[model samples]
Target: MNWDRLQEKLSILSDAAKYDVSCSSSGSKRTNKGGLGNASFSGICHTYTPDGRCVSLLKILLTNHCIYDCLYCVSRKSNAEVKRTAFSVGEVVSLTMNFYRRNYIEGLFLSSGVMKSPDYTMERLTKIAKKLREEERFHGYIHLKTIPGASPELIHEAGLYADRLSVNIELPTQKGLELLAPDKNHKEMVKPMDEIKQGIVQYKDDKKNKLVKSMKFAPAGQSSQMIIGATQESDLDIVKTATALYKKFDLKRVYYSGYVPVLSDEKLPALNTSVPLVRENRLYQTDWLMRFYEFEPYEIVNADFPNLDLEIDPKLAWALRNREHFPVDVNTADYHMILRIPGIGVRGAKKIIVARRYGRLTYEKLRKLGIAMNRAKYFIHCGKYYVSNDYDSLQLRNLILHSGKSKYTKQFDGQLSLF
Candidate 1:
């Protein structure tokens, strides 16, 4: 019917879509002329229904016709060659509602180009979300991009309607922001994050006050995406920054999106070379360890092994590197100590902790407990019996890789190995 509107929608949305750094779509770094064929981390963009199960969201932008020429972005003012689009806020709301009703998507991830100003753009976004929550009664997940410099009032309001709100920190450091996105300063980004954090905390403390037009502001909590490979920020640097963000901001998740050279900017890195998919993957692995696995950033990525290993995960690599700490007696190790063992996850480790109260856990009980025995065997002993006679680092490393029993393999996700 209205093909012009449809086309406009596509251009605006796809261009806006480029700014999101959440999906760990790797393909940035390539083999240095004499390396592997390809390696990139991949994750699906998630949408969810009212029932709370995850589905695909029509992850798109309202427009890519951005006023601010962030050098890292395809929609930057300087990149005039690329087509731009911005869907009407009403259009976006309708699309999300219709799509959800028809079972096309579980939710909407609506981001936009900063058209007039952060205030203007954020206001439009706020309108879309408000309409969805109040008029439509749509319970699907809504992830809105919080403009970095948007006012505290706008951001505070955003947290009320949006399931999760994010302000893309864009780059890791202040200098990186200055180099890549000129209009976006580091403080502008961090300020919104800080405000959102405070608002969320306030809502949590005042959850009972429903009449105040507030539920837990961003109950899912705030998340941000950092562009990997856009600048020369090392994996260690990126992760270290994430560690600080987590500690300082109480962020729910710090997503790492591999940079793709969609726009041919002189300041940006070359594209079409394999984006560092493996490296991106490894970073997520390390992030998981930091958040859930009880490992610190310093413990995993340090001087000698500055970059994560391409072949093995960070945890397996760490275990191989530090063989002196292996074969932990499963029956007696504390919960924190149990997590350090490769095969045991938080749930599995918790099970081990709970099951042990009944009796001493044996290797057989561990198998039934769904511990990652393949990875676990290298680090854990059961019932006072150490599995390995000696810990030769090289041989132990190889054994652990090949040690995956079918059950262990099924339970363990390679991407999750670093954790």
Candidate 2:
């Protein structure tokens, strides 16, 4: 009942929330001496989900009193040593309003533990979201984690209030789910994903809702997460699951969290620390190909290799293995072909499309269009210019791997160009 106690609970639950992969803030840095708000580079950031989506949100949980004891969870019901608390519907609305009024965050991201029961828990979540929209009239972004197997009616109603909805696929395989989260079923998770996708599509495609904001059903769309290194599943297995999720669920983003031993439970893989950061990074790269590059899951990971290389990114690794696809003439290649180049991105692909429309694109023109020529050179041939023809693939692979060190730093330094 005490407001101070509520704030303390928020601190405990939110700090317990730091490991969640879905909520990382954008890499953008801000120094807030006098502005309305400031952003930290790491820790509790405001990421825009995926694509050019311009929404940022304050990510938080409703309660940490989870009934299920997922081994990796900090608030898993069995975790007696940690703090446990729940926010009343009004408490959540109040905190969101105060934070919004003070310009601390743009909106709310409210997920919850399986408190009490699924229906009761979902009912509580619905209450908080409904209050935020109706009672408080809070119009900022809202992303709610839809409970799996909740009633279709409740799921339908949720789309009306929240800007985005998500259902984490949790583990990549059914075997992993059975071993780790004993209570949850893969079908139980997939059903809600299908329904959310259908609801959003039905809302947008139906002509009957012409005048109705018809509740812009998750205007930002849905997303899911997979915990990496939680089981013996291969990287290929994880990526295949991710690829299917995006294709079937039309997921906006699929977050991959590196596994950490928080609970020290019996079922979890005793991966002492988490899987190395490189593994998580590679999964993200493969996920990018599935979503944007139109690359199939098997194209990158197959029977021969189930994991990604720690030294190089998936695309570059793929490119190095198949040099026949490279040395593409950026001057004459298609948009899809240009996208396969190491340094060029979606914007650069667009530039090539448009610039080529005006005239033949040359190497000089690529630089002006904001392409990273160093990474692009090996993959592209413009006019008469081509990188070394006798270039050793292994040597080239090493060259690409070494250059990755500079990519992130140079990205911030403006030394490497991008779209």
- Model 1 RMSD in Å is 10.5
Off by over 4 Å in 1: 1-4, 11-55, 208-216, 265-272, 389-391, 402-419
lDDT tens readout by residue for model 1, 1-419: 47677766765565467546553222122122342122122222344322233436667877676789776677777786877667787778778777777767665677888888889999989999888777777666677889987888999888877767887888888777787777778777889989989987887667666566545477667788787777776677888789888888898789777776666644344543435677778888999999899898888987766777878888888877776776687887788888888767899989999999999997678889888776676577675335544436776666556753222211112322221
- Model 1, backbone clash pairs (residues 3+ apart or across chains), number: 13
lDDT of 2 by residue, 154-211 (tens): 8878877776688888899999888888888889998989999999788778636566
Model 1 TM-score is 0.82
lDDT per prediction? 0.72, 0.74
TM, every model: 0.82, 0.85
Give the top-scoring candidate (TM-score). 2
- Residue 154, model 1: lDDT of 90
RMSD of each: 10.5, 7.3
User: How much lDDT does candidate 1 score?
Assistant: 0.72
Q: Looking at model 1, which ten-residue stretch has the lowest summed lDDT?
A: 407-416
- Give model 2's TM-score versus the native structure: 0.85
